[model samples]
Target: MLNTALFMQQIREHPIVATISIAAGTILASEVIWKAVKFFHSQLSGKRPLRVHEVLSFNELGDICAAQHLRKSMPGSPELTKSPEPIVLQCRNMYCSLRNVGKIVEQIDRAVYSLDVAIYTFSSLILADAFKRALQRGVSVRIISDREMVFSSGSQINVLACLGVPVRMPITSKMMHNKYCVIDGVERVEEIRRLKQRKWIRPYCSVVVSGSVNWTRQGFGGNWENCILSEDKELARMFQADFTRMWKAFEKSENNLKQE
Candidate 1:
C-alpha cells in the first residue's frame, strides 16, 4: 500500500523539487511527442526524417533557451559574492596519497605573477619542478624555508634558488615551522579612511594553501597530515604580509647553494 496523499503533501512542501520534477516531466513528454511526430511525418512522406535524432522540437528548444537566459540573468547568491571559506584535506600514512595535492602544485605553476612559499621542511622534487616551471614562465617565486632543514639530506631549497627563485631562511634558534603558500596576490586600490566604511574593501586577492602537510614525500604519504586551501582575499593579504616581513628579516640568509 502506498501513501499517495503523504507523497503529494511532501512534493507541495518542497517547491524546488516540485519545480524540477515538473520541468523534467515536461521535457520527457515533449520528447515523446516529437518522436511520434517524426514517425508520422516519415510514414506520410514515405521517407525517414533526415537527422531526426539531432533535431529538437520548437517548444523544447525554446524552453532550453529560456532556462539558459534565466540562469545568465539571475543575480548571484550573496554567499557567492564573498570569498570562499577554507576547504579541509586530510591524508594518512599507508592510505591515499596526498600527492593528489599535485593539483595545488599545478595551480602554483600556472600562477600569473607571484608565489610566496613558507615551509619548515621542503624536500619534494615534484614541487621543486613546479616552482622551476613557474619561474620559467616569469612568475616571481619567493621561498621561506627553515634554516636547519635547508641543510637536511634531501632539502631542495638550494636547487630551487639555483633555478632563479628567491629563497630566504630565518636566522632563529627556533624553527620557522609554518607550512603555507600564497599565490598571485593582486593588490587592490587604497581605501579612503575619511568616510565611514560601509563596504568591505579587499586590498589584495590571493589563494592560500596551508596546514600540517610538509613538502616531503613522507609528509604526503607516510605521515598523517591535514591541509586547507583558502581563497579569502583578506586572509591571503595577511599571509602575504607575514611572508614579506620574514623575507625582509632574513635578508642575509638567502640560500646561494649551487644546484647539484
Candidate 2:
C-alpha cells in the first residue's frame, strides 16, 4: 500500500519533479484534444490560421521601415550617450559562453597593460582562437583556472601555451566557483547558470544585459554559459588585484611541481 499524502509531500519538495508532472499532464491533455479536433476537422476545411499584422509605434516602425527611418534619422551623427557606470552585482541566472565573450574581446586590437582571467571551466575553441588573435595583436594575457577543470588534456593546452596565454590552477578551499571575466579597464559581468525545472522544459527566457547583448552560446560540455562584465574602473582594479594574488599562489604551486 502507498501513502498518497506522503508521496504528494515529496513531490511538493522537489520542484523539478513537480514541473515535469505538470508538463506531462498538459502535453497529454493537448494530444487528446488535438486528436478529437482532427477527427471533427476531417469533415471540414483543414487549414492553419492566417497571420496578422498589428500596428506598431514610431520606433517599432523605424525597425520595420528601414530605408525611410534611416533617411529621416538625425544627420550629424547622434551624440554618444553617457554610459552609466557598472555596479556590483551577483547572479546564478545568467547564461552566456566563451564564444559570446569574444565579441567584445576580439575588438581589442591594442592593449597597453594586461588582461587577466580567473575562470573555472574553459576548453572553448573560440576562446583559444580569440586569445590567439589578441596575443598576435599584442595583449599580455594571463589566466588562472582550476587544474581539474581543464577542458581538454592534449592539443588545446599546447596550442594555447604556444599562443602565450599563461594558465594556472588555484588550490584554495573554495572551488574557484567564479564565472566573471574582467575586460579592458571597464566591464565585469558574470554568467548565470542554465537549467530546466525538468528535462522536458523548453528554453525561452534568456537573461541579457542592456549594454551587453553580445553573448552567444557555444563550447564547454554543450550547454550555454555566461560571465559578468563591468565598466567600473574600481571593480576592474579590484579583480586585477585578486588575479595578481592568485597568480602568485599558482606560480608557487607550479615551482613545487618543477622541483619535484
Candidate 3:
C-alpha cells in the first residue's frame, strides 16, 4: 500500500514524465494496430507482393523499392550484377554510393574521343564546364536535351551551342525524357587515364551510363537518384542508335522550319 501511494505521488509530481510515458505507449499500440490492419488488408486483397527481403526488382521508371517489407534475406543472383565485366554502378540516396554529379564530371573529364549525351533536363555549371574542357581536348561532345527545359534558368544549352558543341532538341508536346550517355564507341572504362597509360590498351568499346539520375543540383543532392555505367557494346549501340535518330529528327525539323 505504501509503495503504491509513493508511485502515485511520483506520477502526480512529474506530470511531463507521465505524459511522455503515456504518449510512448500510445505510439507503440498504434504501430501494432497499423501493422495488424496492413496484414488483414493484404489478406483480404489477395495480393502477394514481393518484399524487400526478396531480390531487388527495378521497374522501367527507375524505382526499385516496391512492396518492400523489413526482413533478413540473401542478395540477388550473381548475373544481376552491373555486367559480366567492365561495368560499374553508381547509386545515390541509399547505402554508400558515389556522388552522382561528381561521377558525371569524372566520366566527361575522362572521355578520350566522343561523348553522346541525351537527357531530359540539365542546369549544372559544373557539368557544363566539364563539357567545355572535353571540347578543348578535341573530344566530340554532343548533347540532346528537352526543348522546353533548355531555356530554364541556369541552363547550359545556349552556352554549349555557342561553343560549337552540337546541341539537339526535339519539338513535341510530349517530353523527350531520357537520361543516358555514351562515352567513346565501344567499352566503358571508369579509369581512362590508366587505360591510356598502357600502350597496348586501345579504346575497344564504349560505356553506356543510364538511370533515373539527371544532371542537376536537385537531382543529385536533393532527390534520390541512381545511375548504371556499363561497358557492353550492345547496350551502348542501342543508346547510340536512339541518340542518332533523335538528333536527326530534330535536325530535319529545323530544316523544315527554315524552308517554311
Candidate 4:
C-alpha cells in the first residue's frame, strides 16, 4: 500500500490539513447517518418528508417591497384607525400565532407616544422598518439589545442607530436576555423627573408586550413562541421602570467608558 503510505506521510507533514480532513469526514458521516435514519423512519411510517413549499411561509416578512411599504406606512383600516382597544379585557392577552409578524407590526404601528424594546436578538428588517416608521411619526423609540448580538451577522441594531434611534447595551458580561417592549409607557428617568413637576397623566393607554419571542424571522414564523400583550397599568408601569433603570445604567456605563 505505497499510496496509503504516501497519504499518511503527507498528513503527518501537514497536521492542520489532517485535522481539517478528519473534522470534515466526521461531520459528513454524521450528516449521512442522520439523513439515513430519517429516511428509514419516514419509509417505515409511510410518511413523506415535507417539501419546502409545503411548510408555512412568511414571504411578506422577507419581501423587500413589503418592507418598503411598511417603512412608508402600513395601510390603514377602520379597525386600525380607531383607538386601540385594550389588548386584554381582564389583564393580558396571550397570542401564539404561526404568523406573528403582523401582530408585532400592528403593535408597533399603534404606538403613539413611546416604544422601549429590550431583546436578546433582532434581525428582522420589516420590524426594524416598523420602528423607523414609528420614529418618523414622532414616537420616541429606544432599544437595549445584547451586546454580543449587536455584532452578530444580520443584526439590525446598527441600522436603527444610524437612523437616530437611541440604542444601548448592558455593560456586564452577562447576556441581556430580555425580550420585551413597553409601548406608550415612560421610557426615561428624565421623563419621570418631569412627571414629578407636573400633573402626570398618560395621554394614551400603556401596553407591555413580552414573551419568548425574539424579533427574528424564525421567531415570528417558524418557532413555537408565545407573546403577551397587556394593558394592565401596573404591569406596564413595572416594565417601564425596569426599562428606565436599564437605559440609565447603560448610558452611565457609556459615559464612564468615554471618560476612561
lDDT values for all models: 0.65, 0.45, 0.65, 0.69
CA displacement after TM-score superposition, residue 173 of candidate 4 (Å): 1.7
lDDT of 1 by residue, 201-252 (tens): 4333357778887888777655656666666656677887888788889888
Cα distance off (Å), candidate 1, residue 29: 37
lDDT for 155 (candidate 4): 86
Worst 10 residues of 4 by lDDT: 87-96
Clashes (backbone N, CA, C under 3 Å), per candidate, total: 0, 17, 4, 0
Per lDDT, the best of the predicted structures is 4
Worst 10 residues of 2 by lDDT: 85-94
Which residue pairs clash within candidate 4? none
What shift in Å separates residue 182 of candidate 3 from its native position after superposition? 0.7
Per-residue lDDT of candidate 2, residues 64-112 (tens digit) = 3334324433465332222231110111112222222333343332333
User: Candidate 4 — which residues are off by over 4 angstroms?
Assistant: 1-99, 186-202, 253-260
- Comparison by lDDT, 2 against 3, better one: 3
Best by TM-score: 4
Those runs of model 3 whose alpha carbons end farther than 4 Å from true positions after fitting are 1-98, 186-205, 253-260
Write down the worst ten-residue block by lDDT for model 3: 50-59
Give the distance in Å from residue 77's predicted Cα in candidate 4 to where it truly belongs: 17
Residue 258, candidate 2: Cα error in Å is: 9.2
TM-score of 3: 0.54
* Candidate 2 TM-score, C-alpha based: 0.42
